[model samples]
Target: MKAAIFFERDGVLNLCETRHGHQVVPLRLEQFKVNPVASVLLHQLKLAGFVLIATTHQPAVARGDLSRNELDLMHMILRRKLPLDDIMLCPHDDASHPCQKPQPGMFLEAAFKWSLDLDRSYIISDKWQDAKAGQVAGCTTVMIRSPWIGDDHHDFVVDDLETAVAKIGLLQNNLYGREVAMA
Candidate 1:
C-alpha cells in the first residue's frame, strides 16, 4: 500500500478570490493562477515516495455557476504546474453528494483507487473541511494558518506550505528511524 499526501486545491495549490470573507474559486480560466511555492514544497514530498493527490470540493458546478469544461481547464493548468499524481473533485452542492468536503468520500475514494494506506497518509489543507475529512479518514491533517481554517481539530498547524512540508519530512524521518531501530 502507498502513503499519499492529499492537498486542498483552492488556497493550497492555487490562488483564488475572497468573497464575503470566504475563499471562492475563480470563475474563469484566465483568472486561475497556480502558486509557484507549491511546486518546491510538493516536490520534496514526491521525492520522499508519497503519492501526491489534490482534493477539492467544487460545488459551483452543481450550483450552475461553473461549467465542467471550465473546471477541467483549470485542473489542466494545475496539473501542468504542480507535482500532483491525481486531482479528486466533488461536484455536488451538499451532503446529498457524499464526495464533498467534511465527508471522507473523496479521500476514501482516492485510497481505494490508489491502494493507499490511509492511516499512514497525510492531508495538507487550508480549510477546516479538509481537516475534518482527514481526521475521519485516519490520515494526519496539517492546517495552514488561514482564516478559512476555523476552529478545527488538526494534527499540525503550520505557517506555510514550506513549513508543512518540513513537518511531513520530520514525521517521515522519525518513522524511518524507529523502523531502523526496531530492525
Candidate 2:
C-alpha cells in the first residue's frame, strides 16, 4: 500500500483570525497566510516520498462569508506556494450538511481520488473534528495544538509542523527498516 499525507489548511498550515466576532477562514488570496514551518515540513515530506494532500472544511462558503470563486483564488495561492499534490474541501456547513468534519466523506473522497492506502497514510489537523474524520477513515491522525479545541481523539499530538515532520520521519524510518529486514 502506498502512503500519503493529508493536512488541514486554516489553523494547521496557516493562521486563522476572527473578525466582527466571527471566525474568518482566510478567503482572499491576500489574506492567506502560511505557517512559518509549513514550507520546511512540506519539503521534508516530499523528500520522504509521501504524497501531499490538503483536506479542509470550509464552512465559510456555505455561510455566505465567501464565494466559491474567492475560495478558488485562495487555494490557487496555496498551490503556488506549497508542495501540495491535491486539495479537497467540504464547502458545506454542519447544520445543512453532514459531510463536513467528523464525517469521513472528505477523507474517503481523497483516498479514492488519490488511490491512497488509508492504513499507510497520515492526516494532520488542529481541530478535533478533522482528526476524528481521519481516524474514522482509517488514517493515522495527528493533532496540532489549538485553543479552540479543549480535548479530542487523535492518534498523536505535536507542537508544530516541524515537530510533526520529525515524528513522521521517525515513523517512516522504523517502518521502512522493518520492511527491508523482512525482505
Candidate 3:
C-alpha cells in the first residue's frame, strides 16, 4: 500500500477570502485563483512517492447556490495548476452526510480506491473539519493555522504551506527513515 497526502481545497490549494472570520469558497470561475506556491510544495510530496489528493466539502452545490459544472470547471483549473492525483468532493449540505468533512468517508473512499495506508498518510488543511476527519481516518493531521482551525484533535499545526510540507518531511523521515521516505 502507498501513502497519500490529502489536501483541503479552498484555502489550502487555492486562494480564499475571509469574511467575518470565515473562509469563503469561490462561487464563480472568475473568483477562483489557484495558489502558485502549492504547485512546488506538492511536487516535493509527489517525488517522495506519496499520492497527492485534494478533498473538499462543496455544500453549496447541495444548497443550490453553486452548479456542478462550475465546480467542475474550478476543479479542472486546479488540476491544470497542481500535481494532484485525484480530487474528492462531497456536495452534501448536511453534516451527517458520510462523505462530508468531519466524517472519514471521503478519506476512506480514497484509501480504498488508491490502496492507501491511512496510518502512514497525512492530511493538510486550514480547517478543523479536515483535522477531525483525518483523526478518524488514522492519517496524521497537519493543520495550517487559521481562524477556522478549532480547538480539536490535530497532529501538527504550522503557519504556512511551506512549513507544513517541511513538517511532513520530518515526520516521513522519522516514520520511514530518510532513504525510504525519499525513495
- Give a tens-digit lDDT track for model 3, residues 1-183: 999999999899999989987788999999999987999999999999999999999989999999999999999999998899999999989978899989899999999999999999999999999999999999999999998889989999999999999999998677668677689
The TM-score that candidate 1 achieves is 0.96
Instruction: In angstroms, give how far residue 80 of model 3 lies from its true place.
Output: 0.7
Full candidate order by lDDT, most accurate first: 3, 1, 2
List ranges where model 2 is wrong by over 4 Å.
18-23, 95-98
What are the TM-scores, per candidate, against the unseen true structure?
Answer: 0.96, 0.89, 0.95
lDDT assessment of candidate 2 = 0.81
Model 2 lDDT tens row, 121-178: 9988877777778778898887777664337678888987777778888888899899
Q: Which candidate achieves the best TM-score against the true structure?
A: 1
Q: Model 1 — which ten-residue stretch has the worst lDDT?
A: 92-101
Worst 10 residues of 2 by lDDT: 144-153
| Deviation from native of the Cα of residue 127 in model 1, angstroms | 0.7
Tens-place lDDT digits, model 1, residues 1-183: 999999998888998778798887887898889987998888888898999999988888989999999999999989888889999989888875679889899999999999999999999999998888898999999898899788978899999888999999899889999999999
User: Against the unseen true structure, what C-alpha lDDT does each candidate score?
Assistant: 0.90, 0.81, 0.93
Model 3 has a clash total of: 0
